[model samples]
Target: MSKPSKSNLKYKICSLLSLFFMLFFLFPSFIHADTSLQGYKEVFQDSPIIPFLNKKESSKENNKEQYQRLEDVKVVPGGQSIGVQLETKGVLVVGHHQVKVSEGAKSPGEAAKINVGDTIVEINGQKINHMTDIKPIVDNSGKENKKLQIKLKRGDKMIETSLQPIFDKKEKAYKIGLYIRDTAAGIGTMTFYDPKSGRYGALGHVISDMDTKKPIDIKQGSIIHSSVTAIEKGDNGLPGEKQASFQTQEKRIGNITKNTDYGIFGILEKEVNHEKYEEAFPVALSHEVKEGPAKILTVVDGEKIEEFDIEIISSVPQKSASTKGMVIQITDPRLLELTGGIVQGMSGSPIIQNGKIIGAVTHVFVNDPTSGYGVHIEWMLEDAGIIKPESNQNAA
Candidate 1:
């Protein structure tokens, strides 16, 4: 080819230089992210994150916070659902002794008569007190078309049922498509307890499937000792998340009583470290929380009590008509740097107004961490079995 002229060559060089600058400035924003994420740097600081290779820290803490064990969860008089993703295989019980079933098949996952709350008592004449005892019978039945008879406890009555086997292509063997869980796991904190009645509540929301995002069947959501791995603070623009390792501990911390927008309720099987408990942080009256300054007691940032400044943006006595009665404006910087502001896993944090706990931070407006939802303590207290739903009733 003939030699290119100087003018043409310079033009080509300028064009290439312009293209390089454009790519350097704009490609990152246009590049599709392999993962959907929310985090914060400084304002106007647009640095890209290089994926870190280190594994997150383990979640268990040998030192528990000094907490006050209340007799009952004070009544906010509100309520909430259940899908919990389970890893280890176990006899799947839906609620309070309900076992789930599939449409057809005679094996582990089959049987139409079995309802969600029926408790599986025995499998193939073997006592199925726990999951380990139940899975093999179900698995073997699927593989060989073996007839597996399952004896279960429904309410108080004992019933025996058999499931036929079928092949499941997903497992490359005979299968019944039944999800199983001995219990669910998550990173949640206790909100309050009632000393008068021995009722307590924690994790101010329903535990659900991370994937399907559906509430786990209540029967399936018995608590387990969850290991919280990492924690981020709640902040103005970003939200916080408690990364935890799911672990199963049979030590019953408590029994679930109810669930609502205020959170879930459970009664302690026995008193937790009573000495470790300090007095409960009282919730504030809606009428008390105002448009000035307030603080939040949060477990974000590794279970430490980090306080933040926020404005009671607007007080809607019944905004959700479910839980939080007031709205807030998160105006803290440190919290914003950690959690954009009320992110997942931050639900149930007590919003202290005038030194009294008024509400639990329930949700962060997706686009705005500075603004989010709060459930009134009164409703939470009622749902947690702290008091009778109609406590202020006239004597009959």
Candidate 2:
């Protein structure tokens, strides 16, 4: 009955095109919002998505809360030389060996898909504690002509596999073609101990396997009192070390629970005493540490916690956890003369400034014997479970 006029037809067509474009652009925004909401639910509440959505706002709020909590944290700085003995959760596979049989050369460990960094915790149904523990099992499996069941830990996952042992005619023994170690022992200075919780931290770095250079998966460990016998004074291009002796089996002063990049954490079985420093001191956050005069508490001699002057050459006010939070230089004439600055065993020596424990010595500069790096006491405490940071207090 009615045909639209040309002008009206044009207007109607233009209106439809406008509506189409509007929905096309707006649809994506709606979908994106919904997808983000779903993702948020799938992630933990404390996930980084919240900050990504509003970094500036979230960061301000987080920093405020963190600084507030920092005011409430109190810890005692440690400066005692200690002996460390760590037993891995399982036998750590350090390297592989080639077994020579009548047929040819082969490695059973390699054939079983085992890697160097794997920790062998069990053989068959028996728990493996030492390298010796595997010998009998391997011999029996070889004699019985059965595949040996192996349980190992790779990262956070537990893996199981089976491998046939090869008989070595020369040695008259079965070989798994793997080099393993179950225990590690060393000496380090104690960084700090919490008088309240008995928790302590030391070695301001991970206890890594010397061969694989991987952090040890600790089953259990202990710390004992050690006495420094001598020091190989460091010089330019070479790092010095502290010669120490201790009775590892005599008595355990503490129990180790964790080995982290920041340090080793544990609970002290008894109150640790430092000869010159018996009283506990307050700890300072990374931000509170300043570039100026400071001191370090470390034992260079028999059972004595001596305070040596040092300079906080430069301080990094870490917004997050880091190993190198401060640059330190040895200023005490006695320390410099005795140890030629920070030595290997001097790591974890408590750095004190303004009567507060600010950080701990972590590393020595190879080219500069008198200078080294220090980690903030705050990060050490966090690693020790003495204080928990609320947000991105520091990044690795």
Candidate 3:
């Protein structure tokens, strides 16, 4: 072919450069869209995005089913006081101790890079469930003069390390210089239970380690029947508490399987009895809860669960799981006089509105004892895996 014109060659070069720049900028958006699609597949399986993108009719149908399912949920409101004992999945390192060795004061665990929040799951290839499990292995390793192998979990990562135990001359034992804990015990109100499935949710919040202030990784746990012994009435600037006790040998009421930011969840071993709340009530989604009069089921006297009036000062319609979904105030004269509003042990007391379960008492206002924060019951059920909203199919 004849030689091309210089202007035509320049036009071809300019066109190619323009296309390259366009794709470079658009590539990031394409990757972002693909990543979001994958996340939706994992988190929003029932709410199909592809159908909604292709057909407007499909989006309307999916939205209707979600609302219908929320209206159909039935839950047994729980107000009974319970004692919780949680065992960690592994031996949790709460603090580090200084060991008095022949050389001087030092912490072997610190030297091994074991932090305060690290959970020791395995030592020398043996699984560790309790503090006792670690003592034997440490003692033998020190006596035999062998380096101990430790496998621990820190956050979402598993870590392994080897360290020689320090022989504490003063204590006459092998010391890793770690203060570890295996179990945690506390009292809380039962929020709700599903009579059909025997599943229960409680605490309305996560159980954090006293020292580490991080959520404990649950291995297993149990809830026991407890009786209110006394009430430390609250006031401005000081939150009150409910003193309760349960026999150590008392039979467990439930088994805890998961601990999340929302609360603790488990399967109840037996049916809970509440004279006033014998019937199961429909649960309301966060959007359905309104700012108005409501009632709370809680134990203020002995073991008796009584209903007390409260007002939902404000309702927050959350689209995701959150701890505080509403602001509540005690309106009942009896409850206001008895506990001075919500107390520590009443963390999971069921809040009922319009004869339906709306949420649970979570945190008491330090400045205003009459008012505190509440979490929607819907989030609690979702965290417990009792109600799978994403798995609900559209009504045919």
Query: Whole-model Cα lDDT per candidate?
Result: 0.53, 0.83, 0.85
Q: Model 3, 1-396: lDDT tens per residue?
A: 899999999999999999999999999999998887666544543332122222323333434422225546688889999999999999999998899965679998999999998999999999999899988899999999999999999999999999899888777889998999999999999998876556789989999999999999999989999999999999999999999998753757788998998889987766678877777899877878899899998997778999999999999777767799899999999888988988899999999989889889999899999999999988788776666755322110
- Candidate 3 deviation (Cα RMSD): 12.8
Q: Quote the lDDT for 170 in model 1.
A: 44
Q: How accurate is candidate 3 locally (lDDT)?
A: 0.85
Worst lDDT 10-window in candidate 3 = 47-56
Point to the candidate with the largest lDDT: 3
Selected candidate, larger TM-score, 1 vs 3:
3
Measured by TM-score, how close is model 1 to the native structure? 0.55
Write one digit per residue (lDDT tens) for candidate 2, span 1-396: 899999999999999999999999999999998887655554533442122223234333433422224555566678888999999987999999999988889999999999999999899999988878899899899999999999999989999999999989988889999998998988998988766556789989889998888999898998998988988999999999998898976867888889998889987766776566666777777778889999888988877888889999999888777889889999999989998898899989988899888888999999998999998887777777766665326421
TM-scores, all models, native as reference: 0.55, 0.78, 0.80
Against the true structure, candidate 3 reaches a TM-score of 0.80
Model 1's C-alpha root-mean-square deviation from the true structure amounts to 23.5
Cα lDDT of model 1 by residue, 72-115, tens digit = 22332111111112322224455322133355333344444666
Q: In model 1, where do residues sit more than 4 Å from their true spots?
A: 1-134, 139-164, 167-173, 195-198, 219-229, 232-239, 244-257, 269-277, 280-291, 318-321, 392-396
The deviation in Å at residue 91 for candidate 1 is 5.3
Index of the highest-TM-score prediction: 3
TM-score: model 2 vs. ground truth? 0.78
